[model samples]
Target chain A: MVLRVLRSMIGLLLFVQVSVASAVLDIEIIGAGEHQIPIAIVPFGGDDLLAKTINAVVMGDLQRSGLFRPVDLAGKAPHELSEVSYPDWQARGADALVIGSVALQANGRIEARFRLLDVVKQAELSGQAVSANGDQVRAVGHRVADLIYEKLTGDKGVFGTRIAYVNRQGKKFSLIVADSDGYNEQTVLAQNEPIMSPAWSPDGSHLAYVSFETGHAVVYVQSLYTNQRTVLADFHGSNSAPAWSPDGKQMAVVLTRDGSSQIYLVRPDGSGLRRITFSGVIDTEPNFSPDGQSLLFTSDRGGTAQIYSVPAGGGTEQRVTFGEGNNFSPRYSPDGKGFVYTHFINGKFYIAVQDIQNGQVEILTAGGWEKKPSFAPNGKLILFASEARGRGILATVSSDGRVQQHMFTQSGDAREPVWGPHL
Target chain B: MKKLVICVLLVNLLAACASEKPKEVAAAAPETPAAKETVAAEPAAVAVDPLNDPANILAKRSVYFPFDVSAVQDADKPIVLAHGKYLNEHPSRKIRVEGNCDERGSNEYNLALGQRRAESVKKMLVLGGAKASQIETVSYGEEKPKATGHDEASWSQNRRSDIKY
Candidate 1:
């Protein structure tokens, strides 16, 4: 028993230190956003190296969004409002301009002060000082970008968010958490067995995912801070697809203990086990509504796999998808106005969204090996799994089906990509 | 020195008894000298388990299914039934049925379909006289595939269940 405890302690230590210094994913953006904002970000004045790093991060974030076109500065660098030259920017067709400065504080913290100016009006739109530890230079840059993006686009920026995905190379599978830009990749769990369906808790403090290390599919909730994990469900047969409620108190999981894949609700502590669906068929991938009053899932009880909605307390299930192909992996938009899912037709899967009120479906991708569509917290982009060059890669498309991005990992086939909530 | 001589005589007697009934000696020889003696016996007189014998039908362990279908087809029913009979006769043995799927549907959906395929085999095994406790079922979804190709030929090979002892 003492040896077992020591072995587990060693295992815990290995898990906590499992962060891999992997190459940042190569991203390809396609289809420019409608009405792209022409913005020029001037290099900050203080701390040349620090300013360059911050500017690079901020510029990369805006470019990847495909919603902004960078204006050429032509060697124009302004540190303050007094040094600003509005006529030149206007002549260069820049709608807005951004200027920032970074300084290393005596307390070992880095401070970045930035401002967004409406060039046509020659007035300041927004300005603020963002500060963080020296090690969190990227965080400060993301914050500055968020403020700029919100001020210009009138939408909350997601550059500060993170995403979770599973990287499978041969038989070795790892659950990874990385920044939304696919940098700072951290391996939450790495094992020889397969890991699937990682769902972030509502608070983003924990991740509930399915791991097969126990000889079967079992759901585990692991703390992102302590690297501690507890088995949320290990019932006989498969226990997978753990989706937390919006309130974070309860989670929905698919279990085969009583025969057939069915959805069940249980508290975060594994108590209050209750079966919600009685289809006696394949009913998996349960995602909660934003209000926590209902769940959207994929079921095949109607002779074909399609999306459906059922109340949180287990009542009549209403079909949500109809027409040509089958749909799977339905995730409600953040506003609960519509849902995004994978539409499988003609042996290909495409990410599609449907308006709940009008029931109008819009195909967001050209269609190929795409699956597991999920919405970003802001509902501006939908992340999904896609295949490129015969390897699984993470892909995202804007809600309007215009802007798309394909992010390819360096080593393994990245699958099951889920965008986390806004930080 | 006298005890060593007696021990040698006892070993010789045990070896003689093991050669006469290798099966009984092999069955009873757990951490005993007779187990090694039984291993030395002639192969012709020893009994081999059908599961390990390549020529036996029980050695054929896999059951295939059509896309999105869980029912065991007639072609693979015999293999599952053979394992069921083997498990019934050998009550001490237990087997696990691992289900797999092609790379077409969502991973979670494929996991459920794979599980249904495994459970379908388990149901047939129980019907063929194997006890429910003797069988365990698991689904690997599309995580494990026998063929990596994207065509139908490879997908058909991947949509299968393996009965492992």
Candidate 2:
């Protein structure tokens, strides 16, 4: 009877010690405010090649969001959960920590096990294991981002998507597809004439762009895999600014064979040539809304350059922009919440966003001459053109005005970038 | 007879004095700014009819080139002189220039070509005596077909520059 009583007392003492350790862990993190939930990514444990690759990718993903600042692991590493000194983490200002290890398991399979902790809540957020080889190290890193994103943003993350853009090298123009990080660039079309606009089809299997190969701007849709190309329209006038429909069956472009520069719609098979607008002035640069209900474009019918929207089937157009200077290139957000456009006023151009409801213009950047704004698939990042010093370069900003990333084509000039659909 | 001869001489001297006095009065008058303004506004106004309502209500402004070239036209001498005179006289009148194409090219190419046309006009207004700040230009390209049908008569109308008040 006495032994049983002593055993229960010992168990209670052990529980108390564990609770005390957790309390210390919570108190040691920085800015783990009421809103800022803490997480922990423990030092990656593995050998040189595998460890270096995984750690670098994981760190790169977290740092890009601008919402996350990674904690460095050094020789003062704790041997186990018991040896994890809460005071040291508190000094380092880590609200949370992730302890993970990567190694080869049975059957020649590589496995990575990761554990998440809410240092302040004194609880575990998540502990997960993902199986992948070295070839998939980059993808696994994205999965880690997804895991962290859901915990922090309360929304699923889409980090697996790609971006396609027009790259100009010397006098040569090419349609280049690359990973969003500006890596693994692949050329789909290499042509001498300038490629104006490159838009991804709804299914992402094909791309539609304007090429000046035939001495006039013509819309051509081509499959990325097989390189099968078809000219959508090479009409009598300007066949320019091709925007794909949500279903990818038809494309909208600007043609003036009738009288003036007016917007027209053509099928993927180049059968129908229907006029969508008769502005009696210039109307071009049409972009389809994600739901395919309306088309937005830049028109001078409003007395000056302004953005206007018309139904996809054609109807009364409404003025969407009402600022002093001219606005061009209205690319709607994937979620249909807002749009990004090139705002020109005061002898300068900057990217501005106009909410579909209030029509309020929010200037996304200042001082830089920005044009051809494209939204990231997640609707959290914006890519646009910024001229730095003497030349033009590509720049990005997070939707919330937090993150900014510089991207470019090594081929010289990377212009008119459109982030592909969520992968 | 001697008295009659003296009377005739006196009448002849009086006529000579009257003619010389009027000639001297005309020579003494200085050229007024209004005269200069009228002189300046006349040539531009003569280029287009004033009663054409919208077209000539404000003398139809145009972008000028030295010869027949599509390059951003430079106002050699006369157009600038006319634009300056009109601006100085009609200070409150805001002028808008609508550029046109001769219907020789496709619609999109003509639009760009017409824009270059209007830009030439804007540059002239700025360089000429007119205030660079007051003028605005729009390129109708080949859309506002000034003339219907496919002949030179229609093409001439299509290539014209209109002055809008």
Candidate 3:
């Protein structure tokens, strides 16, 4: 099954590269749950280009979520709610049906309407209409998917969100932002130096990262809109590992100017520098808790690298992880109930999540060189960097580890993925 | 003819004795070759800077460390000491110690670890009579790896502190 899926993924990747002007990430579902929601998405009735593109985008979003298995409609689509045949969808093993239509208005605007139906009950669940310009048809489709996903799952959808990651090809490194489904990739910053530790601000307007452009590690915060950036930390020694506070007013960074690697809190403009952790050993990778009262970091004060927590203002450090192998890059879940990190054991690295209240560790991935796990805004999925086919690839796993998907780029290695907040 | 031969032999003997005396003088003043060469007739050898001399221990710039370790090992002490001595002798010369780590753990933690490694070497250089101001330390973490392979052999080669003058 895995081989067959991989072969299809490769074939689709080649087709996408040759046929499409705007390239997209190729997703390969690694594992699936025993039961998947079967849904049928009827092609939106329109001969225009925008309609077909929106239809494909909606289906792709649902299929990538791993929660719904889209059944092939075999060119049979309903243009409106009255045309949808509930019995036909049910016969094709579709528990739910989606019917939509897109039309170009006389004012040069695109209006899209979709309806969700229960095949068994033969009842309409919900319906909504969204209008946008021709350029925003993709985003309109994502919004439609979001509505459908929430109606069925009782949770907010992440299809409309974005993710930021680093892509390295030869001597060039670029920071790219793409849709949650790995489409519409845009390189925000491209340089000849190495970029690491990309952290999105609370408002998702800026990204603070470490760059080695000046022959040393310096932290910089770049604005996604203005295309302007400011040097956050450029101390004498090494300034790296920039993590934003939950409120977006302050940032936690690792600096070695004073002495060993210690955590320091600095404003976004690089002022009001105050040391937070006073550990004699290495203290780095500071991440603010969801409540913004404590900081989770990795330290080797106990002779081995482990996750630890200290008061955001400064206090005694407490070790939080006691599992075998080393744990690093701890990121709090959206709700702050748990945190995810990269765990190394038996010569293999895995992504794991630990409950904050009970300290119970649950390994989410089997075994791969996985690192830098960042939770989605809803906290239902975790995006991380893993090695596949001897190259780095971005992957996502359901928080419970039931479903897995790999997002591979055609060129270069993709790593250090940080899921953006809901816009 | 015999008198001429005897006179020539005496002159040759005197030249040999003169050469033997300079050899004894060169041995007596072993540490001051420049001064001894000035007094001799042969052209003086060019002075080679010890720092640039491959035969000198100061030429060894990289001080390797064990995996995830920052402490300076005993085997690498000689190289550090040679650099320390050179820095002390030439107080005007400034050196920067770059700390690096293998690609294993988190980049931030490795940055901290690399800083520790660089600082440890800087501390040792200071303790060995080099001025604190003459040396600067920077940790490149795993960003500037000397080896790209993901193995013990490559990793060991990458975990090091290089002294740049």
TM-score winner: 1
Q: Ten residues in a row with the worst lDDT in model 2 chain B?
A: B51-60
Q: Write the residue-wise lDDT of candidate 3 on A1-423 in tens digits.
A: 235323422322222111122656677887765567899888777646877788788887776666888887977878787787778888899988988788888887677887899998999998878665555567778778878888988888887777888888877888887778667677777799888888998877788998888878899998876668999999888898899989999999998888888899999999999999888788999999999999999999999899999999989889999957999999999999999998987778899999999999999998878989999898888999988887889888988898888888877888789898876
Find the 10 residues in a row with the least total lDDT in model 2 chain A: A18-27
The DockQ for candidate 2, computed on C-alphas, is 0.02
The per-model lDDT (C-alpha) reads 0.84, 0.61, 0.79
Task: Flag the better candidate by TM-score, 1 or 2.
Answer: 1
Q: What is the lDDT of residue A22 in candidate 1?
A: 53
* Residue A345 error, candidate 3, Å: 1.5
Question: What RMSD does model 1 have?
Answer: 11.1
DockQ scores for all the models shown? 0.59, 0.02, 0.54
The reply for model 3, stretches above 4 Å from the true place, is: A1-22, A103-110, A131-133, B1-46
Ranked by DockQ, the better of candidates 2 and 3 is: 3
Sort by lDDT, top down from the best: 1, 3, 2
lDDT per residue (tens digit) for residues A1-423 in model 1: 235323322322332435656556688888888879999999898999899988988987887777899999999999899999999999999999998789999998888988899999999998888777676677677778877888888898888778899999998999998777777778999999999999999878789999999899999999887888899999999999999999899999999999999999999889999999999999999999999999999999988899999998899999989998888999999999999999999999999999999999899999999988899898888888899988999988888988888888887899999999864
Candidate 3 residue-wise lDDT, B48-149, digit = tens: 565654433455688888988999986566567656766776899999999999978877788888888889899888766699999888888877677778
Q: How do the predictions measure up, each by TM-score?
A: 0.89, 0.64, 0.86
